[model samples]
Target: MTGTGFGAFVRRAHDAGKLVVQPRMGMSEPDRMRAGLRATRDARATTVGTITLDSYTRVGDLESAELALLEGVSLNGYPIVSHDLATTAGVVEGLYGAGFPIQVRHGSATPEAIFRALMTAGLDASEGGPVSYCLPYGRIPLSESMANWSRSCELFVRSREAGMDPHLETFGGCMLGQLCPPSMLVAISALEALFFHRHGVRSISASYAQQTNADQDAEAVAALRRLCAELLPGADWHVVVYAYMGVYPVSPQGAYRLLGRAAELAAGSGSERLIVKTVAESVRIPTIEENVGALEYAAEAAARTPVEPADSDSQTYAEAAALVDAVLNMAPDLGTALLLAFRRGYLDIPYCLHPDNGGRSRSYIDSEGRLRWADIGKLPLGGLVDTLGAPAITSGELLESLSYIRRKFDCETTV
Candidate 1:
């Protein structure tokens, strides 16, 4: 815990030309969790370990987590807060190293308690964002989530001063994990990283989930990279692309095919890391073997995918830059600027119903399967939003667009 953090390990692996693959894994039982970590480490690929928390732990229901752990009831993930430090330390003691760093991941909008428990246990890395974790997950007010996260970030920074390299990953790019346009995803990712940096975090990762078209995904990640370079100059940052977080492909072959595309996208876009999905993604919870299988598949795919030259004039870059510039100029600090941007409709998310979110914007898939903004609301896109996409889509068209990828990948009658 007093050693290299997740970001530095990822950067080191990247510098050595290795694509680090990680899984969303956890088990309430300490031995099982340790076994999962060992499996991830022994996978035939460059890898990192994860201790994803259960739903109870995620929503701050620590009592339920404790009861489940004591009653021998299996939880979906590890409950770091409910489990004592000895249990967690034993689970990861010999497993975590420079070559095998671990990150604690929970989908919590309010993570103060979680952060405290992690600090006491000497864990250093985690992921979430105020807007991204709040909107899709629950009814927590956006302002409240922001306040909680601000405090958590501040508390976690103490780890850095205590000789631990604490790092965080922003879940912004994967917001709603679906039909949102690439430019919007890129903007949110950039903004959240800035928020983390303002709260005293120097090591962070900006995430981008794979969407429909490979080229569009490539452009989006490229834009994310450029924004980090320009904005996070003093912060240590990298781009991590997630496998499609929407409706997953049901068929094993389809799932693998989709995951392969994500690996290729990450490689071509100059991203340093990838979050993988297993073949069982469309069905039940994946076993450790399935996760390992997915990791190996993605690694092999990354090995074969060639990195293309960067796109200097990408439309994604232009549109995302416009959004970032508009938001940054709205207020003095990143956090207040973000809150004001949403309140003023300058950084609206499509279809997000959060109280603070200006929900006037909408997105749909174009004929070519690229996500396009159906309506840009009051976002200062400089006419770029108006120039692209079809007229506002019908409700039926929206439903079709939501199911677009699932149908393409899961249909019995294939091309």
Candidate 2:
């Protein structure tokens, strides 16, 4: 995590021509929109900035962000990929307004209902039709029991045959909420490779987010190396350097350094495209200035550092790779594999209580084999009956309060 060491590595990768994709989290919906627009403008303004992959939580924000970028930026026919449907609309509309063709992210790998949603969303937003579909939850586990994978894959084939370009995104190190772990991610990556063999994709972007510590992340990286070797032996691909800006507990300086390290590793390993995240995210929602500041930080660091190979002999890397393979082979179905991994605690993303869960959240299992819900509620001590006024208010205000928060933040947010 040394700043100097990691920064130099990132710079070297840029010098060698790699694509770096930075995730600038949105403080509010508006801020997220603004960030997306600014990203496209910045990318189109220079050779260094060619294409930007933007993410949005809601549809309106996506439209707003893409509009902002389309209205101002000029590109040499580069495309922008949005992780949300709303953002896809904005991109399509922007492209039409800018007198260019629009591309949509049609995730045909999802359920029929979801695929229909994507198609309907695309048709509603575009003039010529959607050109691309982005699958953001890393790779799809092709276990037979998961209906989503087969449906989506079939759609991908249909899309390709119809001359539409489809893209597969690969996850980086850490496991985000409900998003599978690196081991599972490795399985999905393998699945994508097999899918691509039958139906050629327009491109593959490794949207690598640095998760966990250097030790854990390095292990995941090693797993990726093995996965690539096994899944995509002779396939041509491009690399997208996704920097984990806000989530890590590390300092902004340390985060940038880690990104540099990752970029160097990717380059030495033969990745072709790279971009750096702007350095502003050390906490919740970075301002535009912070975004600019962060990107500058990574750029300056890269300029000073330059990427090179780090020590590659660690056993952690090998062990992690084996773990990934083992998990992929353990189950007959993707959903079961995923559930089994969760049962064994293979993938553990923090589960906070529903905002309505009155803030009560817990991870520890009780000795009685029961899941304990951490009570975040501030109730008077005596006992549950006492707190509820001798059980008279069992379904009253106390119940109402607990009910509200759980539904608000907990149930709605996570899977």
Candidate 3:
């Protein structure tokens, strides 16, 4: 199936007023991975399948992945690159197509080999960004990542020669998964989508992971949509909301509540898709049944949600727009612009310890439960939002903020 098949499938679901939910599932054994995809496809929701890659494959350690496979050792995820083409193809043979599109989710800063293997397996959609996959996962130099991703995009686009329209999703918005604040997240996600478009990717999805405040997250997704619409004219693009990527709620009730809120956020914000987290997330790798259960639960929650109009005039939009404009103004090329943005601190992720990141930026959860910048660093949002004279976040306060959602939901459940 062509990559555009995935985007088309999602667009159809959204047009029918359905939210397309997907699982982050992968297993080492082909039979197990096939079973997971079958379960995801059969779940009681408008769904898609995901083949998440193993850590060894993610870091390009194919030798180790092959060794694990040969020794019959279990792996955390599917090692697509290490598995033979025919074996991976057989895993998705009859399951993947227009009706059940599958995406390979690999957290790789350098993904050329992964891309090649997936395309060979006839899968066209995948997620990851140069900035997102690089800093959070490892110490790969930002410049090197940019080069790697640029080549990967170009390579992916070649699928069009065989009548396939490959789809790429940006992981930029989920940076650090927690306290980086929404505006920065929105800006980076949009920037990465632009980067993909410039490198010849026509079908793209911009992602936003759920943050602390529901209201704030709603505003962030709206800003992301506006940015993509304005910048990516004539491109096939959509918004995807990821369930909270931080310290998940430990209790089943709390976890389900958090996932429910994420579903509502996706439906209310007019996002086309959602990447779900099962209740088992806080404890361990979820089973196929657990994943299907989460998908069904999220679908039910979303069905009950009414789409709310966005606050276009909100602070989130203004701040995010400012950040995007600042980066685009840096250079004509989006990749170069991103490199320059980080080099000059025009774009900085709060609390990110990567060497290329400008460490001056910091954030704190406000008393109102919203993420706010404590230190804006050299980001060009000086007058848009005020951080001047704000006190630095203390370590104790940071720890509390990191578990803010878990505490809020778990406490509510107990009460």
Candidate 4:
């Protein structure tokens, strides 16, 4: 990804008082390590952290060695692990044993396992300070996930009712595979609309890994542009970019201009926050040093840029909202529209309006993979509304479902 706009966004975020925590995931090489080191030096971030694998982990013990080098360098501490109980337990134990106050991140394939891990980690972390578990509640069946979270909240409320410390530290919502192809820019925009309405979440810093080779530069930029277009809907929302894995830089000076394009897209989309990747990331994990350099380069570019808006109309917003309505309406009917979208391979879904009471409830993806909606007689009721609508989940109701979980746990709302 390009870095030109990233530095400026980081400064914007810092000015806005958002805590920037760049957690480096795949530090698989020395050049990558150098990149990350560079990013650290340039960012001057207040906190930094890295994930480590222990000897007993499915990977190996090299994680411990890696953790050692990162100890003094990173201000925040964290461990990333699988959804398994043993793995989560082992990683949490190892991090704590090292004497660093830390947080744990794990996918929620097995909520039971996560619940147990949280219980243990929270108890242990309490001995040091506030222990947190960054839960990607966004992946759950929204209705089911929200309901389960509500139940969990009831449990916490009951804990308080019983005079016990709830102690469950959670950050709700994560856009991991929120949209596939990972390059659907329009899908990203629709997703953002849904995100705000459902979760009431205003900001986040999420990351994704693309599968393009070093030579596939155009393909890479397209994917990124799609992401930028979708996620950066212009001034309405904000995001702090954090992509450190993959090949770290690209060819043609034009490669560097991609981030600038994304910035332009964001400006046009009305997005409020942004932090784009700076280094070429197709080859290896980035080192802090290289990461810093990439950010500097990106920062310099954003310093001299202006965004041009694409033409649209008030009717356009309504049309876009209609498409969203059609997709979200499918929830009650098994997402017939989403199934159609899948069949049609329509890349975008528009957000035309806010449903009367709240955002639409329930989003369904039909067997065909398109979002479905109720029929209003002969006319097809909903779908992607704009120039090239992208795939996304934008029902306000869905957003609220995730918000319910996030608020219950006091977790980070964005990312």
TM-scores for every predicted model: 0.97, 0.50, 0.99, 0.40
Tell me the tens digit of each residue's lDDT in model 1 across 233-261: 79889999999998888888788888999
Please give the CA lDDT of all the candidate structures. 0.88, 0.37, 0.93, 0.32
Task: Please give the lDDT score for candidate 3.
Answer: 0.93
Q: Pick by lDDT: which candidate is best?
A: 3
Q: RMSD to the native, candidate 4? A: 15.1
lDDT of 3 at 265: 97
TM-score: the better of candidates 1 and 2: 1
The regions of model 3 sitting more than 4 angstroms off are 1-4
- Please provide, for model 2 over 1-415, each residue's C-alpha lDDT reduced to its tens digit, 9 standing for 90 to 100: 0011122223344555543334332322323444444554354211121122233312213455456455754221212332355654554343222212122232222334433443543321110001012122323332322444445545643544433344444332322312223333333444444444334433444433443333444444555555555656545444444454223322454545555655554444444333445433334444555555555554444444434433434343343344444445658654455445434544323232211112221222223312122331331111321222212223353334323322322333344
Better of 1 and 3 by TM-score: 3
lDDT, candidate 2, equals 0.37
Error of 3 at 104 (Å): 0.2
Q: Ten-residue segment with the worst summed lDDT in candidate 4?
A: 125-134
lDDT of 3 by residue, 202-288 (tens): 899999999999999999999999999998988999999999999999999999999999999999999999999998998899999
Total clashes in model 4, counting residue pairs 3 or more apart in sequence or in different chains = 85
Of the candidates numbered 1 and 2, which has the greater lDDT value? 1
The deviation in Å at residue 97 for candidate 3 is: 0.7
